[model samples]
Target: MRIKETIYKWIFTIFAFASLLFLVGIVVVLFKEGLPIFKHVKLVAFLFGKSWYPTYEPAEYGILPLIMGSVWVTVGAVLVSVPLGVGSALYLDELASYKQKAILKPIIEILASIPSIVFGFFGMVIVAPLIQRIFKLPVGLCALTASIILGVMAIPTICSLAEDALSYVPRSFREASFALGANRWQTLTKVVVPAAGSGVSTSIILGVSRIVGETMTVLMVSGGAAMIPVSFFQPVRPMTATIAAEMGEAAMGSAHYHALFAIGLILFLVTLVFNIIAELISRRFRIKLGLNR
Candidate 1:
């Protein structure tokens, strides 16, 4: 028994170490390839320059438009998803009976499991045409369309995580609040949600991260325009879309290839920051709740 246990522990430890080793290898490769772009274009020019005419005679490589595209879509997605997601979570945790909860939770998980390309196809054939007809726009493919799609995609993630966070609040907390004369609504708002604030916040941040990293749906529905977006109605191209659309055509050792890697590096950093923040929040909350000894 002892020998078997020792072997199982060593196997698990090796798997864990392999995962870390792969992560470090990816980071090193990303930096090595991405850093070369600076030799062709100055850092500030590549980051903030207005034009992205990489194929033009002068070969401008500014990524400001791509950055703004991601920002606009992410912000719009947050606005559309946060309220609905959080509300669904609250309803599931506090209002729903056992039967309703069981049915809805599985539906949410299924929604999360649906392929991204399916969402893109749906957006193109269904949502885009609807938006164009409703708004009387020249085209339906724009940041708004991408935002709506990504928002729907993010909903399952937010709802699932937030519901789990709410479930983690001790039953005694609700009983105490009731004994203090708080009604269900007051107890939920003042006591329960506050107790799960860290977890709720973590869920939200992770949802935003998912939005930021999305590629196919945005590429299909976001009009594929490589210009800074001034309104939701305007077409925009996010960094991920740019990479996906152009990487195949860029030469292996060209500046354009390095530039795509640079974009990936920026995206990697942004995702890392969001994850770190979520982890910190969850850890602090766990320690405060005495769940971590």
Candidate 2:
């Protein structure tokens, strides 16, 4: 039994090390490929440049439009998902009957299992046309459409994570609140939610990261226009969408190729920051709750 345990430990350690190595390799490759854009385009200019005419001579490599588009779409997705997700989690944990939770949880889990391409197709076929009609826009495929789709996709993740967090709160806390003459709403708001705040925040951060990395759904519904979107109705392209849309057409080792990798590096760093922030906040919350011992 001791030998078997040692073998299992070795297997887990090897797998963890392998995963870390794989991530480091990808980051190294991305930075190496991306650093060249700074050779021709100044770092400030490359980041803040409004135009992205990479095909033209004296190739423009301004990534501001893409960055802005990514921000707008991600914010929209978060706006749509966070409230709905948190509300669902609250109901599941605080209000819903066991039978209701049983029905809804499976439905939400099923949503997570659906392929992204299918969501893309649904956005293209159903959402795009509706937006065009209502907004009278030139194209239905825009940041708003992509945001709506991504928001729906992020729901299951946020809801599940937040529910788990709420569940982790001690039952004694709830009973103490009740003993103090607190009503359900008061207990939930003053005790339960505060206790689970870190979990809720972590869920939101994870949802943002998931939407940031999404490619195909954004590409299929975002009109793939690499321009600064002044309005939600206008077409825009996010970094992930640009990489996916142009990867097949861009020549290997070309400037455009490097630019794409640069965008990828930016995304990687952004997600890493979010993850770190989430972990830090979670730890702080645990300490405040006296649960870190």
For 158-230, candidate 2 gives per-residue lDDT tens digits of 9988888888899999999999999999999999999999988998898889999898899899888888888
Structure candidate 1, residue pairs in collision:
none
Per-model lDDT: 0.94, 0.90
Off by over 4 Å in 1: 1-16
Give one digit per residue, the lDDT tens place, for model 1 in 1-293: 99999999999999999999998999999999999999999999999988898788878899999999999999999998888899999999999999999999889978888888999999999999999999999999999999999999999999999999888888999999999999999999999999998989999999999999999999999998989999999999999999999998999979999999999999999999999999999998787666775
The parts of candidate 2 lying over 4 Å away from their true place are: 1-19, 288-293
Name the top lDDT candidate. 1
- Score candidate 2 by TM-score against the native: 0.92
Cα lDDT for residue 141, candidate 2 = 96
